[model samples]
Target: MEFPSRDLELATRQATLESDTPQIVGPQVVLGQGGFADDDAPENALVAVRDQSQWYVADSLHQARELAGKVQGRRSSLEPRPPLELPEGDWALTLRTCWVEPAYLETDASWCNPQDEPADPVANGGAFGGKIASDVTDVARELAQANDRVVRVLWSREDTVRHGPKRPPVSVGLRADGSGIFRLARTDHIDERIRPLLPKCEIEQVTIPGPPTSSAIRGAGWAEVEMLRAGLSGQAGWVTAPSGASAKATIANELISVEVRAGSPLDWVMFRSYCIGAAHMAYSWVTSEGLSVDQNGDVHDLTIRSFGVLRSSDTPEI
Candidate 1:
């Protein structure tokens, strides 16, 4: 896997600056597991300070100064107070320019129920791009009723993954009769949290009690099912069999192989490419027996670069 080179460089620079400081207050240090580093620690007074006492050292120089201001405020004894007024406005929106494909709409549609009305119809795009539309709507309706003002709802990608409904994981058991015919039994472990979130679907699900990670991405389950189905069918040698009665006779007599490999990108990329090429060949064989070239070719590949600066003060309140 490719490591974060740019992030490491910034971290190294911050470390060099931090080494200059002899000591930091307990409340002025923040420790995080991953992502950007920021010093948003609670305020405490520095003891035994000399004339040249270092105030702040941060990943970003600007952030260091911001931390100095925070530390200064904390050191000065003052009564704790909240903001007197909240900022009021109809905010402008901007989306991150990521590799988002319009064709990916299928995944979004599968997760949301169009018939279900948003809780705050005025602000329809609720958290996580409608990943929790129902829940958001419910909250918005309640808030709107209490405060007779239009409330706008917005969802960040992170929020969507954290709180949005997830696709349930499924396990399938297949028994082949040494013939083309196979018996399949599927068991799906549906998340109880998502039961209330999703509209009624055709599949009957069994609820399992456990702590499911909220970071489960979209189509998390379908990929596994597709892999299993492909392997099972491939093992049975169903791909090579001719159509009609002859194919039926060979189905029961054929042997199938199922192989699973877990590895990093460098270890598996070549194998993955070979598998994809084979799959395309198989598709051509099934659809047009003699077609040798790809019909839908690659259009274009594009890359964009940008810079993101994270300050200690900008850290999210978890």
Candidate 2:
């Protein structure tokens, strides 16, 4: 499934605009779902505005503006709450939650173990395989809390990006004999944010250590590690197998608007060339060895080339 990059971009833009004005002009409508599996589910539509010197949720933009007007009319209630402080050093946010239900059993066959079944058909898995999970709900709750004045507001893009859950970078080690026979494979992934959100599987993770910056992103440490393992495995050999494998990823907040325009083309072309070269080499290796299938249907000297592409669309606007 695709990531919600467009929605996030729009929301970030709205947040920036709202932060600029001193008085609450209108409700700021930030769009995006917070929880896991929210892609197939309804997206959370948040409208935040000032109310009596504190932030409050307005169901709609109009309602938010009305509340802001009322707050302006009043001289003052309690002093305005202090702005939330951003964390120092790089940080990222992550959110997650989980739910489970039982279903009936139609037919049963077991490996020497017996079990009872529910009466109704169980729709057990996620909408899109394992894509949907608790992370969505966790993020939703965090956003709601921030909007409701339970937590301090996130005021800037730098704060949001640095303090949010970052996509963990990964490294893989692969070994093969001189003839390209697969051997040992090892994968490593590090979530620099993990230390702060200790013991909380469903967490409002932040790379920066502190209280005010407690919002969540989509997947946390486990997801990053699992994805890295799968990705490295696929890179090593899965994509070339008779039964091919594929992957889809959505990266958020990696670059500023300025950097995206400046860096995308060079990155894209280099990656594309790498993929083409790798595919060609793998194919050539497989064909040249003539060690195709014997009577036993076995082949030798198979070389799996690890390479990939991050291509740009032909349309420059893309």
Candidate 3:
């Protein structure tokens, strides 16, 4: 599964031509899945172990405690697994959806194919990138096909953080007055990632080895870039959604105010909550949070306590 850099360049070019769309470029590789396993059945792990180079078939951290008596602290050695084989795709394809929220359509529209359920973007809202749970649906469906039994695929917070896709870490340089000089990252498709949002800024690519990084998380990389650009430009940052939905906001003295226009929010509470959550996430990510990795591309800080996140008092109320 890979969304190559060249493809992102093209997506960005196309997105650049249309100013109304969100700068949402993605991996050349899409994890394509179906259902919940039986409660009594053996639980499956869905994680990508960095050192072992393995993905999606480990014990969830929540379930790790239960293994204490069974394994008596016994641990297995790391053994690298080969990447899964998937068909090639036309990376040249591009899409633009902005100001089109309250919109969704996916799957075959027939219940006869359960495997296609996770592909339902309209109903799920896809939780930004959190909707990767669709991967589990595929795992479960495959197991059910082989053994004719329910195979539940689940993971804990630790498993998620460890294996999940991340907002690509960036290297941004700014002048004394906040004008950006360069924003760089190997994990991101820089062509369409930040440049589209901050048209005046420049970005360079720096090679670095690590686990998968992406723009799929909530607002992801573009959010941070737009916010930074907002500070530099002394104006509200512009935002667009895949659904063609859009919003604008400005931050002064650490306070944020947003105005949105998105096809009439269907549910006020859900729409408000979703926007608030994303705002909080974007604020936290741009202002206080970051991940640090060691020389071997291993993340030294694994526990939540080590993430050094902003305290509740630090977060402003709307």
Q: Which order, best to worst by lDDT?
A: 3, 1, 2
In model 1, pairs of residues that clash are 119-137, 127-155, 128-155, 178-252, 179-251, 179-252, 235-256, 235-257
Tens digits of per-residue lDDT for model 1, 178-237: 112111112233333222222231223433321122212322333333333455455432
Best by TM-score: 3
Instruction: Provide the clash count, candidate 3.
Output: 22
TM-score of 3: 0.55
Of the candidates numbered 1 and 2, which has the greater lDDT value?
1
- Cα deviation at 157, candidate 3, in Å, is 2.2
Go through the candidates in order and give each one's C-alpha lDDT.
0.25, 0.25, 0.43
Off by over 4 Å in 2: 1-55, 62-165, 171-236, 239-311, 314-318
RMSD of 3: 14.9
| Candidate order by decreasing TM-score | 3, 1, 2
Task: List the candidates' TM-scores in order.
Answer: 0.25, 0.21, 0.55
lDDT per residue for candidate 2 within 1-318, as digits (tens), equals 333323434433332332221111122322323221212221234443333234444555456557566321211122211111322222233111111001101111001001211111112211111211213233334545445422111111221122222222212222221111111111122223332323222222222221111112222233333333344344421211111223232223541111111122223333333334333322332222111112221211121111111223211111
